[model samples]
Target: MQNDWEWFNNNPEIKKLMQHTATQGYYFILYYMYYVSSASSVYAGLAFGAPIMDMILPLNETREKIPSFPTNYGIDGEKYFILLGIHGFIVNAMAMAWLWTTDAFIIMMVYHCSSLFNIVGVLLQQLNMKNCNYDEQYEKKIITEAIIVHKYAIEFAEFIEKSVTKVYGFIFMVNMIMMSITGFYAVLNFEKRKSEAIRMALFTVSQGIHLFLNTIPSQCIINSSESVFHAVYNCKWDELSIKSKNLLNIMLTRSSRPYTLTAGKFYPVNFENFGNIIKTSLSYLTVLNSMQ
Candidate 1:
């Protein structure tokens, strides 16, 4: 794993990006930790303390059950309602822990992918701006190296995309669903449980930030990939020999296609898709509100 990381970080651009994103990733983890802590506290309280508390404080009837963490002991579907809410507590705690870890992994993946794309973009830009000498062999060697670098970068991005596309799709769908459901509950129950509502709101926002972090970098890569063509077009290509010009034309043609990171190939990650997710979630929330 260390060897693989070393290989990935071999590029200066990639190393710098990794360092920058590590700090951001840490912030995201911390934010998620707060949300998880707040949410799990409420869940733990309700899951374990509800039955006992119900005898005193009493639970609101309108609130959802099953969420009450009741264990039905009788065969006739009768709830024992024993204070054995430990099972619910355990399950909730485990799931929340899993989610927190998963969030960190997802954040890391996004940063890694973004860094690779950024490095590729830098390579393309450098290639376009590289000075060509009058020495034919020297110019050829430099341009050839640039081409190899560009191809290497493209292949690396493609590999990363293929390996993570399905994962990205899953994360996207799950995050959006969580956002919608959490936002709906947060807004609907603001009066009943202000702290719970606030926790849900924070969860929703964290999910949004997670999605944004992935999509924005994807959009940046897409834009950067396209920018390569412009870079090539504006370069000092007129000074090159016919052979060099032909090689550059080939590179330009290849770069024109660009690289894209998609979510299972069904959806491309971008700001536009991110907006659509938010709008769709809001629409669902609106409908749910109207029903309530």
Candidate 2:
């Protein structure tokens, strides 16, 4: 990650943002632990009290096939509960660890990618400084530097899309489906066990937050890329030689094309698309409610 943006190593502001983002990602993991613990307690209760129902996890087949942890409740009730508690803790911890790691990675990629793109806009603005009374040679040098930075920014954007988009996309879809199903079940079982339903509510909210957090940064990338057009157009093109004007025009043309981060190239990760996802999920939830 550091190597991807090595050009900005000396930049204090960029460094600060990167540090803040990393710290924030870790904080998210800590917050997620609370939810995982709550959900785990609920699942453990189901596993112990209603082993035949298999509501919490698909463990019925495995439980029946494998002589797993002590399930002979009549023979060893307390021992079974003790081992089950330990098993639940371990399983929950491992699942949450995997989830939290993925969340942190996505947060890092989205936040840093957005920041890097915005930094490119700042560089573009620098290229069109009206106050500078430099000679043509100096102006050309400034333009060249800006062009190099802009190219790197585009390359980094491509790298992020190709590497992160599909994985993030799949995760997003799965989370959406889970949120909907969990929400439906929570509503259906609310009166039976309010506490358990509340845990499901928390899970649904966290999933929503994860989706929104990723979506906002993607919109930031789009907005920053669009801003480049204004930055390039504001240059004093008439004052420069035809060659300089031509170069600025090329930059303007490039900036005019919106650069966006997408999920599988099917769902554009922006505010508009996010709203659509919510709307579609709610529609499904409505159908589920009617069936129930």
Candidate 3:
């Protein structure tokens, strides 16, 4: 992993990619934080009859709005409510931190793996026989490095697949359900409860974004892997020595099969599948609305 990090750090193109990904990740986290805070405020308002804006202020009113414990527990005093509020706030903060950290980790892995494939593609595309000093040795070295990086990328992606398949699968299923239910509710309450409908709509959109974050990087890996074949084919391989030609052939064969990330070892995670998931969710939402 350290070697891989070194390789990534040394590559200017990969560095740019990482920078762009980091910027996007930053905004994603900000959006998540906003959503969580807004949802928490709305929940507090519903639970304790506090004004939503007032809930944003850390004061006695907010403390009073903390979720009520059982009266039988003998901890319902005003002083205890302050402690309860602090404890609840800490717990929520921890849970949100864990959630975002796990998501960011998964996204970072996927982006790195995709970037490796892209780097290999760039290397293959840069292969040139027309250069005055080009030789079989140079060709062999470049192709070998590309092949090695390609292999590393495949291994990394497989590791990611093995590690996150169950988690992604579960999230995928839950997101689908959440989207369907929330979308239905959003539409159902649009006339009667505008604020609640907007909240439901935002929740549905959040689920969609989460699914996109998972699948889009997987699609990038697929696209980058496929680019390898095109890069190899477009390169001046015919001018190479027989041994170099053989190496190109090996790479061609290997690159022909694009690596993929899967959910539950069942669905290939990609833009196409992402669209299908949305369609299926909407279909379910329609059915649910009709049943209601």
**TM values, all candidates:** 0.65, 0.73, 0.76
For lDDT, the strongest prediction is: 3
RMSD per model, one decimal:
5.5, 7.1, 5.3
lDDT of 2: 0.68
Please state the error at residue 110 of candidate 3 in Å: 1.7
Clashing pairs in 1: none
Point out where model 3 deviates above 4 Å.
7-92
Q: Tens-digit lDDT track for model 3 on 110-187?
A: 766766777777777657636777887888888899999888888898898898889878989999999999899999
lDDT of 2 by residue, 1-292 (tens): 6784576778776566556655655665566656556655555544454344445666636332111232554555544654655665676667767876776666566556656555655555554566556567776776787778677777767777787788778977997788789789788878986656766676677677767766765776687677667778876676677777888888888988877788887777888888887777778778898998
- Scored by CA lDDT, what does every candidate get? 0.67, 0.68, 0.74
List the candidate 1 regions with Cα displacement exceeding 4 Å: 1-133
Ranked by lDDT from best down, the candidates are: 3, 2, 1
Tens-digit lDDT track for model 1 on 89-156? 67778887887786566556555544544454454354345555446676577677657656655776
